[model samples]
Target: MGNKILVVDDEENIVKLVSYNLEQEGYEIITANEGKEALAKIEQENPDLMILDLMLPKVDGFDICRKVRKDGNTNNLPIIILSAKEEEIDKILGLELGADDYVTKPFSPRELIARVKAVLRRVDYTADEEKQEVLKTGAVELDLKKHQVRINDKEINLTPKEFELLSILIKHPGQVFSRDNLLGEIWDYNYHGDTRTVDVHVRRLRKKISEYSEQKHIITVRGVGYKFKED
Candidate 1:
């Protein structure tokens, strides 16, 4: 199936432009004119990915991002934020709020499409791996080949990043890695960006994993960094 995307924006022109370009790329496009409506549509449509505008009536982008990140079924879904807010803090806050990516406004439609394609590509690569076989960790069986994560045979919904992060941790089992280390190893980006990127994703991972186990699956070392639970 062609990728499905939900574009949430208050501007009609922005909506029409993104919708047109994405549609031309064969992505099924869905849109919302305001934040509250966007949230409602997200609940009903459950698109593969979302493009959210930071400025909107009622709920606003940060609130919506938090709402989706908090939801059990939707927590793992990829969300990309679009905003004209130029402040570095705005961008940082968006990422910290669990946006998979961010695009500044007055932007290139070509770049938007490129980012969308890249995120979809990453999600697809992992999903494909999870379909063929199951991976196991002690009593936890995470079948990357089957896309099923079972702890004592109880299934769970893990986002692509969560699953990938967990797999790396479990496979390593005792590695003490810093955020920078993780960004280098897990995230495909080789160049510049804040290491907080790793920190934010780690927070999400911790939150999602808490749903599956009472014992912490991730651990933090004071004055150092984080590591998978090794005891």
Candidate 2:
């Protein structure tokens, strides 16, 4: 079997359909029909990825996403939200809470599988890369191996996505990156036309880092994209 995947949906048919398709691809599948069960399975199975549905009994997908990201044990776990809600706010909320990707209901199984593969590929690539011990710029310091970031010697917590975004910009100062470019680099997939994801993340990243440093590290290029401050 390949990587283990957890499928959490209240609909039995949806669960069966997804499990069948994933199993055919040689992945081990663990399933839960409700939010609470999903959380439990995550701890016991330690799946490489999770397909989470928003509407579920007891706990909800948003809360689960928050919890998973907050917990040190599963903070780095990859989550893909599978929901029927088409509201832009819902999508933004899920992403803000730390979901790696979002898929609406009535989705193509092939596309979903492709997203799964892309996400796993990014994860493997990050893990396999040879990185310097630490990256330093101004007051910001990033420990690549430890996955820790500190500003002026004071550590701040950042989600995996935020950390990756900062790492990319700080590595290449003065290079402007369009929203599309950032979406491709950080998300590791074409996010259709949702550039707002990049904006939301940048806003949050700025807010977090701003608390510690007076100088702005990430700069908006007005109509363009963004760039890191150079010396």
Cα lDDT, all candidates: 0.78, 0.87
lDDT of 2 by residue, 25-84 (tens): 999999999989999999999999999999999999999998998888897888889899
TM-score attained by model 2? 0.92
Displacement of residue 76 (Cα, Å) in model 1 is 3.4
Q: Say which candidate scores most in lDDT.
A: 2
What are the TM-scores, per candidate, against the unseen true structure? 0.75, 0.92
Per-residue lDDT of candidate 1, residues 18-81 (tens digit):
9999999999988999988998898899999999999899989999988887798787688878
List candidate 1 stretches off by more than 4 Å: 86-89, 130-132, 138-141, 145-158, 174-192, 207-231
lDDT of 1: 0.78
